[model samples]
Every structure is written in C-alpha cells, then in structure tokens.
Target: MTPSKRLLSLDAFRGLTVAAMILVNNPGSWARIYPPLKHAEWHGCTPTDLVFPFFLFIVGVAIVYALETKKIDISNHNQLLIKAAKRGAILFGLGLFLALFPKFNFETVRIMGVLQRIGIVYFICAAIFIKTTPRTQFICMTGILILYWILMTLVPVPGFGAPNLEKETNLAAWVDRLVLTENHTWKSAKTWDPEGVLSTLPAVATGLFGMLIGSILKGKEKPAAEKTTWLFSFGIIAWILGMFWGLFFPINKSLWTSSYVLYCGGLASMMLALFYWIIDVQGHNRWCRIFVAYGVNAITVFFLSAIISKVMGMIKVNANGEEVSSRTWLYDTFFTSWLPSDIASLAWALAFVLFFLLLLWPMYKKNLIIKV
Candidate 1:
C-alpha cells in the first residue's frame, strides 16, 4: 500500500469500533443492559471489552500509515516525536476534561481513563515505531507481555503479601494506589483502576501487535491474499495461545493481562484481515460508508458524544411530577414506554449510534474530517 493512499478497510474497522464504543457506552439504562454488552465484572472477556483494545490496535495501524514518510527521513525524527507528544497530550487532556466535566472537581477526578490510556499507548507505540526496526518492535512487544505476566503473577505486592490477580490487592492495583492514590484512581473501585500503571504495559503490547500487522499490510512485496492468510493464521495461533495461557494467568481485561492482550490482539488482527480482504482487496466498500464516516472523524465524535451524554445526564426534565435527567426522560418517554427493559435499552443505544452517523455522514461527504 502506498503511503499517500488511504486505507478504506482501516477506516471502516475504526468506524465500526467507534460505533460499537458509542453503542455500549450510551444505553438508556445501564441496569437494563444486555448481558453481552456488559463488561465482565472481574475475569473473562466480553464483546464490550473488545472495543477499547480494537481502537488501540487501529491506532497502532494508523501510526504506521501516518508516520511512514517521516520515518524515512532521519532529520525529521525529532519533529515527528514532538508532534506525536503534542497529540498524545491533547488526547490525555481530553480524557481529563471528560473526567472533570460538569463538576470540575480536581480533588476527586479520576486521573486515568479510556482516552488517557489511548494517549499513553499511542505515544509510546509511535516512538517505538520511529526509533526501532520491526524486529525490535516485536521483541519489545513480546518482552512487555512476558514481563507483565511475571510481575503480576510472581512478584509479591508490598502490603498485600502474596502476588495476586484479585481486584483490589493485585500488584497493579497496589501500584495505582501508590502512584495515583485512591483519590485519583477509578471512582467506582477507588483502590484500583482498569487502566492502571502496570496494566498499561500489556496494553502497549496490544498496540505493538497492531503495529506488527500494520507493517505486514504496508509491505509492497506481499500479495493481498498472502497477507490475509498470514494474518488469519497468526490470529488463530495467538488466540489459542492466549486461551492456553489463560488457564494459568486467567484472561482479564481489568488488569489487561498478557493472555488478554494476545486474545484481543488476535481477534483484532483477524477482524482487520477480513475487512482488508472484503473492502480493500475485493473493492466492495459501498456498504461501509456509514462506518467510514465514523472512522474519519473518530476522536471528534467520541469526545463530543461523551460530552453530549454528560450534558444529557446533567439536564433535568420534569417527568410526571418527578424531576429526572433528560436522558432518562427521553428514554422513558420514547423507548421504555413500550419496549421491554433490555430491548429498550439496546434500542436507545442503537439510536445513539445512528444519531452520530447522521451527524458524520454529511461531514464525511464534504471531506471535513477533524484531525483530532
């Protein structure tokens, strides 16, 4: 693939992932969510868990395409790194803004979040892509996963005694408490965070997994069929390995375990391979326009969607003599008044996805992609 040419498959995959993120995030009622939409309480993976890793994987693939030209000119390396740092900072700042919105409580705001993790992973992975060869990147990715597995399973926690993968007393949780403190950690847990310090190491591995695949996709020597075959094979092998490793470490998204990295990365690789074949290779992309819109201006929609959702919750509306959130009032009036609770919740989320699609379609047609 040429550096200048856009990858429709990638944009479609990204759009699909972002759309899934919006859908899972914006249910009319969290309590009435479908089982598949809910994240696993502690261990195991769900469809919802796949969304974040897939986005990071897409980020890694994008870094390859985005920085291809800059990577060649040695003189441009510093400038490239600076630009990446600024973008990462902006993403992290946006995440912080989301956490601090409405209330703006610095004292109690959660420091790390979905976007914060994305920012950190993207910068580190981009640096790795720039400074290291593909072989070295693979080694770094593998080493991080192995080191995390060892640390989380073998090393003992300071005050917690034994090494553990339990929610509160795990090594990652202990590190989060020590560095971010309970105040800055995830509010729901208070003692630990899913996007904590140590777990991010494996998360970086997930990005590297995508970077490796991106390297393959960008290679000129290989035919499209060969690339698809290799990706599918690698994905299946990695998937099996992840499941086997899970027997010991247990695949957990909350900690982003090494096994989980392999599991999700494997699935992401296969999914991208499929998209590349059907959309990019076969030239059957007409069906992907909706997702393409979401893909091109992904960050813009995500940040805006989150802000709008927060505002929806903040705004109060009188509903039958009771003051409820606008979101609740809308859900009650439009969805739950007729449909079953779980189905109504899902319908609301689907409507949210289409709502953004409607907003993005015109922008996509006009080629007005927001860079951020």
Candidate 2:
C-alpha cells in the first residue's frame, strides 16, 4: 500500500474506536446501559473492554508510521526521541489537568488514567521503534508478557503474603496503594485503580504488539494481500492463545493482563485488516469519510465531550420547580419522555456522537488537523 492509503485505513480505524468510546462512556443513564456496552464485572472480555486497548494499539501503529523517516536517518534519532517525549508529556499533562479540573485537588487527584497510559505507552514504544531492530522488539514484547504473568501470578503480595488477583488485595492493587496512595487512587475503589502503575507494564506490551504489526505493514518486501493474510492469521493465533492463557491468567482489563492484551490486540488487528482491505486495497474511500472526520480530530472531540459532560453535570437548573443537573433535565425532558429506558440511553449517546460530528464537520472540511 502507498503511504497515503495506509494512513487512510488507520485514521478510519482510529475514528471507529474513538466513536465507540464515546458511545459506551456517555449513555444517557448508566443504569440503562446495554450489556455489550457495559464493561465486564471482574474477569471477562466484553466488546466495551476492547476500546481502550484498540486505541493503544493504534497509538503503536501510529508511532511506527510517524517515526519511520527518522528511523532511517541515524542523525535524527535523538531529535525524534525528544519530540516523542514532548508529545507524551503533553498528553500526560492533559490527563492530569482533566483529573484536577473544577476541583484542583492535589490531595486526592487520580494520577494514572486513560490518556496518561496512552502517553506513556506511546513514548516508550516510539523510542523502541526508533532505536531497536524488529527482532529485538519481538523479543522485548515476549519478555514483557512472560514477566508480567510471573509478577501477577507467582509473586506474592507483600503484606498479604499470597499471590492474589482479587480487586483490592492483588499485587498491582497493593503497589497502587503504596505508591499512588489509597487517598489518591480511584475513588470508587480506593485501594486499587484500573489504570494503576504496575498494570502499565502489560499495557506497554499491548502497544508493542501493534508496533510489530505496524512494522509488518510498513515493510515493502510483501504485497498488500500477503500482508493482510499474515496479519489475519496472526490475529487468530494470538486470540486463541489469549483464550487459553485466560485459564491461568484470567483476562482482566483493570489489571491489563497479558491475556487481555493478546485477545484485544488480535481483535484490533483483524479490524484494521478489514479496514485496510476495503478502504486502501479496494480504493473505496467515500463511504468512510465520516469516520475519517472523527479520526482527524479524535483527541480534541474526546476531551471536549468529556469536559462538556462534566460541566453539564455540575450546572443545575430548575425543572418542574425541582433542581436537577442540566444533563438530567435534558435527558429526562427529551430522551426519557419518548423512548424506552434503554433505548433512550442509547439514543442520547448516539446524539453525543453526532453532536461532535456536526461540530467537527467544518473543521474536517477546512482541513484543520489539530495535532496534539
């Protein structure tokens, strides 16, 4: 595939992932969310569980494509690494700002989060892609998966003195408490965090998996059709291994276990393969432009939509002589009144997606790419 075609497929895939994220995250009522949209209770895979990993995988793919030029010119290696670190720092800072918004509470602010993890993985993966050969990268990826499995399953928790995977008592959770502190961790589960420090090890593995595929995609030695077949085959093999590994490791998104990484990374690979086949290989592009629009300014919309939702929750208004959040008032008045409970929730979420689409359409038209 030519460079432009490869990018088109990637952008569309990323847009689809980000759009799914918005849908799952902003249902009108959390109480009314559909089963597929809700995250698994503890130790299973769900469609909703794939979104974050897919984003990270895309980040890995992006790093390979974005830094390939510098990879060739040895003189530019340090300059490229510096640029990657700066971008990573900005992404991490944005996540921190989001966590501290409207409260500015340093005392109890959640430090590790979705964007923060993305930033960290992106930084590490970018450096690896620039400095290492494909063989070395593959070995590193294998080592990370094996090492994380050992740490999580064999090593006993310090105070508990038992290898555990329980939500609060697990080794990852224990480290979160020791380092991030219980007070500064996730509020819902103060003793643990879904995006905690130790879990990030396997999260980086997830990105490496993508980086490997990206290296494959970037290779000129293979034809596009051959590359697609190999990627699809790899996806199937990795997915089956993940399911088998789940018996021992138990696929858990919160911990970002190795099994979870392989499972979701396989799914992401197949999805990207399909997009690449249809959009780039077949030269069919018009149908996927809406997703392209979402892709172009994905972080912008994701961040703005989150901030708007929170602000709406904070702003209260009088409705029927009772005070309620503006979000509640809008949902109750327009969505709940006409649609069934779950359907209304789904519809409200779709509206949020469309709202951003409309908001971003002009930007897409003007070719305003907001680089973050």
Candidate 3:
C-alpha cells in the first residue's frame, strides 16, 4: 500500500466499530437495550465491550501505516516523537474537556475515560514503535501483559490484604480509588473507574498487539496471501490462549486484563484479516465508501456526538405539559410512539449513527480528513 493511499478494509472496520460504539452508547432508553448492546456486568465478554479495544487496535495499525519504519531515520526520530506526543496530548485534552464540560467540575469530574486511555496507549505505543525493533516491540508487549497479570493477581491490595479481581477491592480498583480518589473516579461507580490507572498497562499491550499486526501488514516483500495467513494463524492461537488464560484471570474489559487483551486482540486480528482479504487482496472497493467516511473523521464524530448527546439531555422541551429533556421528548414522540420499545430504542441509536455519518459525508467527499 502507498503512503498516500489507505487500505479500504481498515477504514470500513474502523467505521463499523465507531458506528457500533455510537449505537451502544446512545440507546433511547438504557433499560430497553438489547443484551448484546449492554456491557457484561462483570468478568465476561460482550460485543459492547469490544469496541474500545478494537479502536485501540486500529490505532496501532494506523501508526504503522502512518509512520512507516523504512522512511524514518535517527535524525527524524525527535520530530516524530514530538508529533506523536502532540497528537496524544490533543486526544487526552479532548477527553479531559469532555469530563470537565457543562459543569466544569474539577472536584468531582471523572479524570480517566475511554479517550484518555486511548491517548495514553497511542502515545506509548507510537514511541515504542519508533525506538524499537519488531523483536523489542514483541518483548515489550509480552512483558507488559505478564507484568499486569502478576500485579493484578499476586500483588495484594493495600488494605484488603490478598490480591483480588473484584469490582472495588481489586488492586487496580484500589489504585484508582487511592490516587484518583472516589470523587474523581467513574461517576457510575465512585469506588472504581473501569478505565483506571493500572488497567491501562494491559491496554497498552492491546495497542502493541495492533502495532505488531500493522507491521506485518506493512511488510513490503511479503505476499498478501502470506500476510493474511499469518494474521489468521496468530489470531486463532491468541484467541485459544486467551480462553485458557481466562480460567485464571477472567476476561474482564473493565480491568483490561491480559487475557482480555489476547482475546479481543485476536478477534480484531481475525476481523482485520477477513477485511484485508476481501477488500484489499480481492480489490473490492465499491461498497466501502460509507465506512471510509466514518474512518477518516472518527474522533471528530465520536467527540461531537458525545457532546451533542449531553447537550440534548440538557436542553428541555415541553412535552405533555411537562418539561422534559429534548432527547426524552424526541424519543417518546417519534420513536416509542411508532415502534416497539426495544426496536424504538435501537432505532433512536441507529438514527444517531446516521446523523453523524451525514455530518461526515461532505467532509469525506472533500477529503477534509481531520487528524488529531
């Protein structure tokens, strides 16, 4: 693939993930959501839980594509690192701004979030990619995963005594509560943030997994068939290993467990392989333009959609002689009134996805790809 051109599959895959992310996040009524849309309460994998890590994996792939190792030399190293840092900072800042928005509550604002974790993982992975060989990158990725396993399993929580992977008493949750404090943690669970301090270690590993695959995909001499084969093989191996490992660690997305990394990363790898085979290797391009639009301006749509959702909730409109949130009013009037409860909820979420895609279409047509 040329530096100027992108693999259609990657964009389609990313756009699909982003679209799913929006759908899961914005159901008209949370109570009526499909089982697949809701995250597993604890210690299990759900389709909803896969979106974030998949995006991180895609990020890793994008890094390899963007900063082709063959092109960068030692002299350009500092500049590349700086650019990576700047991008990471912008993403981090956007997350922070979201947390502090509307209320501007510095005291009780959730400090760690999805985008913040993404930024941290991207920065660290990008730096590692630039400085290290594939061998070193592999070692680093494995080391982080093993180290996280050891920390979460062997290291005792401070006051709790033995190591545990419970919702609040686990080592990672303990660290989040201790450092980020109850006030600044996830609002839904004040005692522990899902995207907390120690959990992020393994999240970095997820990105590295992507970077490794990205490197493989970027290999110039390798045949497409060979690359696709290797990806499928490794993906299956990782998926099996993760399942076996889950007996001990449990596949917990909230914790970003090592096993979770392998499991989700494996699925991501296989999905990418399928996409690459169908889109790039097969030269099928006619049907991927919608996803390409979403892919090019992913962060832009994600951030804006989130902001818009919040704003909609804040704006009240009179409905049945009582003031209700605009979101609520719209949902009740059009969605629930026309469709079944669950279907209406899903329709509302799908509408949000379409709304954002509409916003992105013109930009994609103009090639106004916003990179952050």
Candidate 4:
C-alpha cells in the first residue's frame, strides 16, 4: 500500500472507533442508549465492546509496522531493550497521569486502564517479537489466549475457590484484590477491573493479531488486490469460528475471553478491509477526511473530553438558591430538551463528534499526530 493508502484506512478505522467511543462514553442518559451501543451485562458481546479492543489491535499493527526491520539496529540489543523499557514506562506514566487528573488519591484510584494495558503489552510483545520469528509470535499469541482461558476458567480462586463470571467471585476481582490495593480498581467495579491482569493477557493477543496484519501489509511481493481479498476472506472465517466458540466460552469484554478476542479481532479485520476497499481502493475520499482527522489525534481528544466533561459537570447552577450540575442542564437544553426521545440525544452526541472532528481536521492536515 502507498503511504496515502495506509493513512486513509487507519484514519477511517481509528476515526470510527474514536467517534463511537465518544458517543458511548458521553450519552445524556446511560439508560437510554440503543441496545447495540450498550455493553453486554456479564458474558456476551455488544457493538460498544468492540471499540477499546479495536484500538488495542490497531496499536499492535502500528508497532509491527513501525518497529519491524527499521534502522533502530538491534546490533546492540541492550540499547533496544532500553528503548522498549522507556516506551513502556512513558506510556504507563501517562496512564497514571490521566488516572490522577482532577484529583490524585492513593485510595479509590484506578490503577489499570486502557493506556496502561497498551503500555505493558507493547513492551512485552515487542521484546519477544524483536528477538523472535513471526511464527513464534503467532504461537505465543495462541498460547497466551488459551493459557488465560484455562487460568480464568479452571484455576481455583484463593478462598473463593473456582472462577465464576459473578462480579464478586470472578478471577478478575480476585486478582484485583491481590494486586490492586483496595479502592484502586476501576470505580465502576470497586472490587474488580476490566483492565485487570488476566484480561490483559488476551488483550496482548489482540495486539499480536494486529501485528499479523501489519506483517502482511509489510509483505515483500504480494499483490495488493490478493492481500485485500485474503484479508476479507480470513475475516469471514474467523468470524464464523469465533461465534461457534462463543457458544462454549462466551464472548465477554470484562473477562477478555479468547472467544471475545477472536470475535473482536475478526470484526476489526473486516472493518479494516472495508475501509481499505472503500477509501483506498475505491478512491472515495470525501467522508474519510473527517474520520481521519479524529483518528489522527484520538488519544488527545479522548483525554481532553474526559477532563472537560468532568469540569463541565462540576459547574453548578444556583437555581432558586439550590445547587445543581449545569452539565446535565446544558446537555438537556441543547440536545435532550427539544428532542422527542433518546434517539435525539444520540444524534446530538454524534453531532458533537463531527464538531470535534472539524476542530481536529486542521491539525491532521498539518501532519500533527499526538502520542502519549
């Protein structure tokens, strides 16, 4: 693929994920979202569950493309190790900074997050890939996915004994208690974290899968058309297999089950092939420009929005001398108030996405990509 071709497809994929993220993350009323937009309760998949994993997958693809056979010479392996260590630390440090923002508390803080998972996986997987073959990398990915599944499903929890999907008894919660000091798990699950250790194992697989794509893209002599066809064909096969496995393992984001990994990986690949076809192959550039803009500086926009939304929620209106959060009032007045129902609020959230995309368009055009 040409540089433009690469940029277009990644931009579109990243843009779509980032936009959906904003929508799901900022709904006016969580109660009102369409079923597809909401996450599965315990052990299932939803359209919403695909976004974070999709981002992780993309990160893996990028790492392979950027780090493979580069002049970053592995002649002095120690130097390469140092570089990997620094990158991992920096990524984790950034995640900590975001977790500490607005308030820094040792207690009741989130220790594991999306960025943290990415950081750890990048370091571990990159270290292995840097010293190993593509075949070994594939084997490692498969082993880790299956290993995590066995550990979570078969290994008995201390005291609690065997693992169950129940919030209180799951391996996730058990490990969080052992590893995360109390109150440091995601606030949504005071005793558990979706970004916990066992889950991260499969997430590494997610990234490894992307590395496979990146390697294929970096192939020396295959025709682009043949590559595209195989990608699409492979996606179909994986989707079918994943669904069948889901019947036994059950696709769940919180657990980051192997089946979930297969399902999301397939979905991500299909979306990529679609975007590559429509944007790169078909030369349809109009709508892609908007997505590319948001996708380019995705992390910045996400963190910025998180902080801004919190700040806005803190703004209070002294209505009749009674304090109330103005954020809700503003969103309702601007988006939810006039709308007939929940769909209107959803539309308003989407408009909010495009508005930010327009804001970010110039930065993307100028080749300004932000990374943590």
Candidate 5:
C-alpha cells in the first residue's frame, strides 16, 4: 500500500486491540474478572497481556506508514523528528494527566504507565526508522533484547545481590526504586512499576518488530500473497523463538521481557496479516466497520474513556446509608443485582466497549478523526 492510501486492516487491528483494552480495563468489578481478561500474575502470558504489546506493535507499524515519505528525503528528517517529539510529549503529558486526575497527587502519583511507554517507544522507534536501514533496525532490536536479557539475569541487583526476576527485587524493580523511587512507582506495588525504566528497552524492541512487518506490508514490489506469506512465516518464527527464549527468560509481562515482546509481536503480526488478507486484498471488510471506527480515533477514545472512568469513580452516590463511587453504585444496581458476579463484570465491560463504539460510529461516518 502507498503512503496516501490508508490501510483498513491496520485500523481494524488497532480498533480490536483498543476495544479489548477497554473491555479488560473497565469490568464491573476488578474482583470478579475472568482469567483471560486478567494479566498474568507474574510469569506467563494471557489474552489481557497481549493487548498493550499489540498496541505498541501497531504504533511501530503506524510509524512506517506515517513517515515513509518523509524518510525518503533527508531534508525532511529534522522536521519529522521535531514533530515526533512534540507528539510524544503530548502522549506522555496525557498519561501523566490521567495519573494526576481527581487526586492530583504529585508526590505519590505513578510516573510510568501504558501511554507513557507508547510515547517513549514511538519516538525512539521513529528516530531509528528515520536514521537507519531496515537491516540496521533489525540488528538494533536483536541487540537490545539480548542486552536486556543479560542485564536482568547477569548483573546483580545492588542491595539485593544475585540478579533475579522476582516481583520486587529484580534489576528492573531496582532501577524503578532507584530512579523513580517507591513514591513514583506503581501504586499497588510501590516497590516496582510494571512499566518501569529497564523493561522499556524490550518494549522498544516490540515496536521494532512491528516496524519490520510494516516494511514488509509497504513493499511495492511484493505481491499481496507473497507479503502475507512472509508475515505468516516471520510471525511463526518469532513466536517459536519467543517460546524457546521463555524457557530461560520466562515470559513475564510485568517485566516486559524480550520473550514476551517477540511472543506478543508475533501474534500481532499474524493477526494483522490475516486482516490484511481479508480486508485489504480480498475486499471483505463489511464486518470490520465497528473496529474501523474504534481504530480511526484510538488514542482519543482511550484518553476520553480513562478520564470518564476516573470521574465515575470519583463521583459518589448514597447507597443504603453508605457512600459509594458512582461506578460501584451503577454496577451494583444494573449488573451485579441481576447476574452472577463474574458474568455481570464481563457484561459491564462489554457494554463499556459497545458504548464507546456507539460514540465513535457517528464520528467515523462523518470522517471526523481526532488525531492525538
């Protein structure tokens, strides 16, 4: 596909990922979540764990489509970098805003999060794409993954001797504590943030993985069938490699391990390829309308949803002589009252996804994409 022509498959893939994110994030009760929706406790992979990485992978693919033209001209490089930096800053600021909302607690607020990581990975990957060849990008990605593995496994933690991948004492956790301090780390686990400093290295590799796939899809000379074949081939190879790597490194989302990067990116690649084949090549996209709507204005919906969810929690209602969050009251009244706890939670989450789809459908019909 050319730079001017939009990729419906990519948009659909992104939309699906974002929809999953909203579903997993906004259950009626966190306590009553299904296993698939919940992130792996420490070392393993789950459907929920795939969501963030898939989005990051999409970010990488998006960078190629967005900047391929500018990349061809060296003169446009500086201007492109400036624009990327500005966009990254906006993303990071938005994440920070979410963290500070309602409470506005600077001292205790978590610094690193999903959007912050996306912003950081996007800028770095964009810079790499701008300056380097695809071959070089692949090499860089490989080197970073290997280096992270070494650092996490070989280099001993300062206070907590002998490098390990435990919850709070690992090298990544140590870096989180030292740099961000316990105060700025994840609220639930003040000792470490899942989106902590060290783990971001592999996260960038995940983006680079998507960039590679994006290059394959963007190739002018390759036939659509050939491109799909390559996507499937590369995806399978990466997935198998990730599984092998996991034997040693273990696939851990909290740490964003190199293994997890490959595993998630590989699945994301195969998924995008399937979408590309069905939607872009065969012109069978009738069922993808809802995803397209979500995909087009993804960041806008995500930011708005998060803000609204936070507001819902902040607003209180009197419930039988007890003050409770509006979200809790609504859940109790509309969902849990009638259905089983787990099913009710899932129902609420599904409703939340559909609600956003309803909001986005009109905007999509009018072609009103709110770029963030």
Candidate 6:
C-alpha cells in the first residue's frame, strides 16, 4: 500500500470516533438521550463504551502506519524512550489541562482522564511497538488480558478479600480513592471512580488490541477484504471469550474488568473493520467528510468545545425574568426551540457538531493538522 492509502483509513476511523465523542458529549440533556447515545449502566456494552477504546485502537493502528511510512530508526533505544516520554508528557499535560482549565482548583482536581490514559498507553505501547514484532505484540496483548484477569480476580482488596467488580469495595476504586483526591476521581460515581488506577491495566489491552489492527493494516500484502474478515472473526471470538470471562470476572468498565476490556476492544475492532470496509473499501466517504474534518483536528475541536461550552455557561442571561445559560440559549435557538421532539434533540446535537465543524473546515482545507 502507498503511504496515502495506508493512513486514509486510520484518519477516517479516528475522525469517526471524535465525531461520536463530540456528538454524545454535547447532547442537549443526559436525561433525554436516544438509546444509542447513552452509556451502558455497567457490566454491559454500549456504543459510547466503544468510543474511547476505538480511539485507542486507532492510535495503535496509526502507530504502525506511521513508523513504517516514516521508516523510524528503532536501533536508537534512548532516542525512542526520550521521544516516548516527550509525547507522553504532552498528552498527559493536555489531559490535566482539560481537567483543570476554566477552573483550576488544585485541591480537588481530576487526576486521571482520557488524554492521561492515552499518554501512559502511548508511552508503554510505543515501547512495545519498538521492541516487539507484531506477532509478539499480539501475544503480549492477549497475555496482558489474561494476566489482568487472573490478577483482578485473585488480588484481594484491603477489606473486601478478593477482587470485586462491584462498587466502592472493588480494588481499583479503592486504589483511586485512596491515592487520588475525593473530587479528583470520576464525578459520576460519587465515592467510586470509573477511570481508576487498577482499571488502567486492562485498558492497555484496548491499546494493544488497536496495535494488532494497526499491524494488520500495515501488512502490505494483506488484502483489505482479508483483513476485514479477520477483524470480524476475531471480534466475534473475543466477544465470546469476553462473555465467558465476564461470567467469572464481570464486564465492568469501572474496574476496567479484564472481560470488559476484551469485550469493548473486540467490539471496537469489529467496528473499525466495518467502517474501513464501508468507507474505504466500498468507496463511500461522502457522509463521513464532516466528521473527517472534525476528526483530523480532534483535539482542536474537543478543547474548543469544552472551552466554548464553559464560556457559554458562564455567560448567563435573563430570559423572562429567569436565569438561563447562554449555551442553552444557543442550543435552543438553533437546535431545539422550533425543531420537533424525538429527533429534534438529536438534530440539535448534529447541528452543534456541524456548526463546530465550520470552524475546523478552514484549517482542514488549509491542510493544518493537530497531533500530540
């Protein structure tokens, strides 16, 4: 494959994940979401659950294409480590910046986050990429999943005895709560955290899973259909194994349950294959263009949206003698005010995404790219 074709699919895939991330994150209201947009409560898979892992998988895939296309010299181990540390620092900083920006409260700031996970995973996976062959990476990936499974199930929480994929009593949650601050953890679960420390172990499997896809995509001789077929088959197999594992480990994202990792990673791998088939293989890329625009500059769009959302929220306005957020007003005026229900909310989000894309289209048209 030529350099261009190698990464086109990866870009589209990354863009797809970013588009979905923004869409779901910017929904009008969490309470009034379409079923597809909402996250699974626990121990189950959802479209949203696939988003982060998909991004991680895409990251791995791109790593292969990038290294091959650039012909990165791997003999220099120190050079590689330094590069990894720098990239990891940048990504981790971005995550922390996001967590603290517009409200930099040091006392109880978010310690772990999406970008933070990416940074750590990027460092570790990059090292693995340089040191191991694709086959070895695959073996290591599976090994990590299995090892995590055994560890989580056997390791006893301070007072809970063995690992529990339940609530605050679980080992992972306990570690995060003990190490991180009360306000620094995932706010949704109150006392517990979904993005806790121990959970990150299996999360690495998600990145390794991506690396496998990346290596597959990088294989010059492998036909697209063959690759896609393998993806589907492996996805089904992983899903089955994950389900069986879940019977013993339970598919909990909070714990980053080993089963949940395989399950989500499997689902993400399959989805990547499907998207590649549909958009690149089938040559159907029209609808995905807007998302592509957003995806190419994913960090830009995401950071902008968060900042803009915060700014809009801060600018409260008096409407009919009642306090109203400026952001809500914007959403209502353009998205929900006159639109019908059912899909009006969805449309509003789509519109928000589109409007945001307008800002990015220019950068894309100018061939400006943002990456850490």
* Model 2 lDDT on a 0 to 1 scale: 0.89
Full-model lDDT, candidate 6: 0.75
Write model 3 residue lDDT over 204-238, tens digit each, in one string.
99999999999999898899999999999989999
For model 3, the superposed segments whose C-alpha errors exceed 4 Å read 1-4, 69-71
User: Per-residue lDDT of 1-372 in model 1, one digit per residue for the tens?
Assistant: 112467999999999999999999898887899778999988899999999999998998988988876789999899989988988888899999999998999998999999999999989998999999899999999999899999998999999799999989999999999999999999889999999888989999999999999989988899999999988988898889999999999999999999999999999999999999999999999999889999998988999899999999999989889999999899999999999999999999999889887789999999987886
**Cα-lDDT of candidate 5:** 0.91
Q: Evaluate all candidate structures by whole-model CA lDDT and list the values in order.
A: 0.91, 0.89, 0.90, 0.77, 0.91, 0.75
Candidate 5 runs further than 4 Å off: 1-4
Once model 2 is optimally superposed onto the true structure by TM-score, how far is the C-alpha of residue 83 displaced, in angstroms? Answer: 0.8
Order the candidate numbers by lDDT, best to worst. Answer: 5, 1, 3, 2, 4, 6
Q: What RMSD value applies to candidate 5?
A: 1.4
Per-prediction TM-score to the true structure, in the order listed: 0.98, 0.97, 0.97, 0.92, 0.98, 0.90
TM-score of 1: 0.98
| Residue-wise C-alpha lDDT for candidate 6, range 156-187, written one tens digit per residue | 88877877667777777778878885778876
Rate residue 104 of model 3 by lDDT. Answer: 99
User: What root-mean-square deviation over C-alphas does model 2 reach?
Assistant: 1.8
Against the true structure, what is every candidate's RMSD?
1.5, 1.8, 1.5, 2.6, 1.4, 2.7
- Candidate 1: where are CA atoms >4 Å away? 1-4
Tens-place lDDT per residue, model 4, 58-102, is 777666665676524768556766777787888787777778876
lDDT string, candidate 2, 1-372, tens digits: 012334888989988888998899899999999667899899998999999999999988887888776579999999988988998898898888889987999999999988899889989998998999878988988999999999999999998988989998899999999999988888889999999999999999999999898888878999999989878988888899999999999999999999999999998898888898899899899999899888878888888888998999999999999999999999999999999999999999999889899888899899887888
The lDDT of model 3 is 0.90
